[model samples]
Target chain A: MSQKILTRMGDGERLAMDAQEIRDDIRRGTAEAARRAGVPELTEAEQEELFAILAEPGRIVSVEPGREVIVTDDGCSMSFYSGQDGGGVGAPLSRLQAVLTYERACGADTTSMGHSDYSYKPVKPIINFEANDYYNISQVTTAPFLYGAQPNMGLYFQPDGPCANAAELMPLGKIDEARAAQEEACEHLRRDLVFVGRRLAEVGLEGLNFDTCGSAGDADYLAALQAVEELKKDLPDLPIIMGGAGEFVLGMHGGVEYQGRRLAGLYPHEQVKVAEAAGVDIYGVAVSTATTESVAWNLARAVTFVKAASEASSIPVHANVGMGVCGVPMMEQPPIDAVTRVSKALVQIGKADGL
Target chain B: MSEALFQASVDAVVRGDAKKAEELARQGLAEGIEPLVLINQAFVPGINQVGEMFGAGKLFLPELIMSAKAMQAATDIINAAIPEGNAQEGRGRFVIGTVEGDVHDIGKTIVVALLKANGFEVLDLGRDVPTDRLIEEADKFNAHIIGTSALLTTTMPAQQKLEEALKKAGLKGRFKTMVGGAPVTERWAKKIGADGFAEDAGAAVVVAKQLLATN
Candidate 1:
């Protein structure tokens, strides 16, 4: 019999379950989510492949070196805080240098200037578009020197800042006021994205990532969708990677709609259709982990969601796997065993084009 | 007539109408209804129902937040009318913030709202708060628990620093410490000697209550 696979729960508890049991859980978990989402379930061959991958007796696993897929990261922060203290203490030139070091070491396909406050709202005030043509122009101009050979280098931000402000209104029973605020914030966010996209494009930036879209619910998602639509019209060739904060939209605004579909309660399969409609070049799918559940369970569920999303999407599918989502343990540094297995499952079985 | 008013109070909260909930609360006060009676019979049930629906996935974050706001608006009025000395007895005091160098406040904000709905007196220090400031404010508030949240790996050290600072001050035993965030795990909590670890807002409440009960 294959050795019993060791894994950890979402909360970091150790579990050593029979290989067959883990395979069974993977099938059962994936089927249940597929049924609920009205997406196609995995075929028997795909299930068997996932089982084989998990049953392998290795401390860590990876795709065959020649068969490796593209790897990209959102909010790449390692280079941002290169100094001894916790804060972002490094200068721009040194930070870019660190990105170069990380790229060569880790073999990431692309690198980003990870902002602690990675949102357009906070960066808006600092960006004097009229005077300098870009916010943080120093970093924007210098990134090309280090990353000249890379096909893509761009800006990333979450549409989360305004969502927080709108949520504040809901408590005072200011529902209408909150809704109006979200609408206004959406417009402002779209304008900021356009301004930044245009400025970055002028300096050879090739992509933009709307990381963690819809974290504040429907309105937040709407803002990102609209921004992508606007950005596509301005720069048709620019690739936009739209990643979600959760598997399903939270319905925070509860009643907002986009392109006639309700923005609230949208699962990955449903979410990708809207993203594609808005001209998203790459759809980043995420499934949150249940801390009490085992990694096998979370990985199976994440695969199920990602596979459905990949099938339904016309755009490339990038699976977000790290920390708390995509079957990785919810910790600062995830164990390599879980990470490798999840990555392999997503690419081979879930049909993910990138990670 | 009184029964109808109480039902209306519950409905106002379910509807997430803070102004209506506040209005009904004032009306109840004017009619000589006991403050505690209004809270126990009306607002608590309303917020409880909201929490239940949220867990069931029938409600989402906005609906839940609005309901909590409505419940708070009514409860604040009712709480003030209670006898001063009897007020806030046994209800734990919680001091919460996103630690310094981290601006992610959504998770911390949700915890604050839920804690308030669950009857804890919460002092929200907001985001990017320094470690020393958290201790100082918690001490001033006589807080029973101090919760720190850090969303980034770099900022997570702030939580460990908070733990060290509390020990250095010789106040470790006095205040129960809770740590949470997207990147935070139970292992980190134990490694840093934190008293409690919550994976999300719902778990935060349970861990907090258990921590208080144990001590």
Candidate 2:
């Protein structure tokens, strides 16, 4: 009864239609109408005109099977969870950097993942700015992500908020109701979605992220799926990601913290596979259950799982290892230390001798 | 119940057992171990580790929050018992809330829990709290600290307005003010005439105490 879309494009293509090289081809497609209606590129006026012509590539309408793009955001308000890479005023700075770096490395687009300080996006007066101009500008104003559609969970839940109104989140808890919680979370999610979507159109955001969709799984995974799907209907050109695994992984529910490690219920990963079956392009695997070992090992497992899952449909997979709160369960970024860096180099290097 | 019952009790909390944590906390007195020792040494420490994990980024929000609730059940039982006597007190009384036009409580709730564990008497006004309501509660409780939260970029100015109103109402110099949440910064606090700023609740307890000591 439900519909599904294929994730891979013809013959494993990777951004063959870039902005600078094939302006006319990009401008003539579905990306064009969306471009004209989206945010403007900051540095270029000529390109801004052309941006309106590009058909945004990641049309993530729902969890329905299809070509999937992803966006990653590390919530700054909840910076308490960022582990070794965190602490102080630098939390947001690190989070944005992670977003940019993660997106670049993992290859996601259409991001509304973390704090929005516009570190990369500068605010210039729209001079010769026409209110009635026919053209749209898509520029990479900030990091390639946005955190909340409305209330960043970073601000709302993290003890360090300039926060969103609480009543707005009444829906996240009411997940048992159909479209209620998803619709509720979407109240904020939508606000950010539109703002970020418009910004993506302006910043030339080609892919999209629907990461928050799966967060309400216990309450209702289908609701989460439908929420992102409905959102995709509104935003047909971006990839949508939906995944959540924090509680089950950490063993808060009478769980045993054994041998200095946290473990998870058996079914959460199954839920992830279901999200994929429900038509999602990307699946998030929380391998942090290996809290005894380290975040990298879990990340490697998660990446391996994604590599396996996405291999068949040809969808690109993204692995999420969020920041640590108390700094104990370390999720190293950019692999700072030599030990970490050397291992990370091996990961990226692809085992020349063995392979 | 014998001490063997308590070993299971201790193991349950140590293992992050939700059902067993409550059962163990309820059985602490019957098992002959002093309630305060269980509260301070075992149960509180379990959550403290959870908090440390939260602070260290080894855990995320859903886990931290669930652990907080699980830990609270054990502490709730301990709080009901006869004092095990002789213990160091937590930090002092503090009041926190989101400014008007905001309706988020996650940040406020976290700070309250963090401060409570750290020994602060916290009066949480909940979300969308009015400045006058905050001031009234602060005055009623003779609070030494007041922390305000605002999430919206549109409403961040409410923090300034709260300070100005506090000043106009002649309460500005009376209490220390701390502002936090996403839109706030240490610089923003200085500009708004807030006494201090902490980015998260764990750090908030420390900052609130330090500000209270100076004031």
Candidate 3:
């Protein structure tokens, strides 16, 4: 006699629904996503295994002792100074602190030195392309590398924020102007990323994480792909991790295309192909949680998408399991119950290489 | 004849042609059409359709932003001709920003455009704005509501701080507070004592209206 499992709404409401219904929905959603992505659907046995994990009555669920996988994180913070901006620690110290904690305390296999300048547009003033006066990338990456952590440098391509604002293209109804401005911004961002990538290579940075790629839609995705392609030309051995900001590529520049493929509305399976073409080593998949739906519903949908993407990809697929996405609830601190269940599903059903 | 011009106004907004929308608005005004009538009958319907299409996944962010821009451009012109005291009579004023240390603003930007389309005088303080500045602007603008957005878990404390600061300043009763962002949940809004929370721009408009009505 299986008991009803507890689930959560996207808005954080707790509800108890029949476990069988949840399983059925997961199967249906997963099959549809797999069919749409033109990838292999989860086998009947895999679906049953996923249902058992989701239906567990425990407060949290985890993989058995030896089935653990590699772990990576984006926007690793400096927790030294709580409530203070940048943790009151300089770049070098912050990077050191984050890597130390993730490696020794959290037992993370790899850590990231995530640097965000609010928006990429503002980086122009702070970055001296001609010299190393602006960014301390080499120093920051070197410390983590020497400390025995597989360190990756993460940056965001949030083109919608500053890029769209600066162009003022929307207000004046200048669609072409907006598209052209985004294209120009892409060039500047590509140069900046390549410059940073070179600095990382100088220090033998383990990997490069284009964290939150395509948040501003297709234009943002294009920028990251262009940068990765250029960097691979010079530093072929350098591994690149491209993490998506959402589950789909928004047609912000609805008409924009990359490698002759229109990018306005692409799912994760389709997105992986473009990332592979751009020479990305690892592809991170993000599936947004629908706040109005049950956690069971969200998890099923997320795994379905990830499963298709994983099967279709030639490279390792790392599922992004964080706040408000990948079946995790949208909260400052997502409940451990949901996180564990989501992590377990991604590993068992989605067949992800990392989380 | 008037119906044809009105439909053209609607078509311009749907197509996201700011110049055409503006030109149609001017033409309507020159033809002795009432400014409010033109907005209410023509442009509002266009924006509303865009919002509906966006919610249904028929359009994307760039299209949505473009539509909002067209609506805004036409509204700016038509709104200017209305008499000073008669305009902004019952419609409320709103102040919004992304919380300090959170630089993401696409969500907030969309909310601002939608609020403006719905006839609210919105003041967007841009991204990474401090709590003090948000309150100060709200006070100066005589705002009935102050909305703050935070995209990260680390910066969510700022929303709680805003709630505390409003209480400490004894301005809590003067204005309603709304919170939003990718990581912001309705429970967090309640925990922080915020008056309202919205998941997206379309929902923000509804929440703002509810908040204003109570105020």
> Interface RMSD (Å), each candidate?
4.4, 13.9, 4.1
Error of 3 at B90 (Å): 4.8
| Candidate number that wins on DockQ, 1 or 3 | 1
lDDT of 1 by residue, B41-109 (tens): 878788777766554335666677678778878888888888988664477899999999876665676
Q: What is the per-residue lDDT of model 3 for residues A41-105, given as tens digits with 9 covering 90 to 100?
A: 67778778878887888999998787787777764443332333433233444455655665666
Candidate 1 — which pairs collide? none
What lDDT does model 2 reach? 0.46
Candidate 1, residues A155-252, lDDT tens digits: the string is 21123343335544554446677677666666666677667666666665556778778765667788888878988997898777888878787665
Cand. 2: chain B TM-score: 0.68
Q: What ordering of candidates by lDDT runs from best to worst?
A: 1, 3, 2
Q: Per-prediction DockQ scores?
A: 0.23, 0.03, 0.22
Candidate 3, B118-194: lDDT as tens digits: 77878888778899999999999999999999877778899999999999999999989999887777878888899
Selected candidate, larger lDDT, 1 vs 2 = 1
Q: What is the C-alpha RMSD, rounded to one decimal, of candidate 1?
A: 6.5
Which residues of candidate 1, in runs, are more than 4 Å off? Answer: A1-3, A11-15, A20-49, A63-70, A75-181, A215-217, A290-292, B1-49, B52-58, B69-90
From the highest TM-score down, the ranking of the candidates is 1, 3, 2
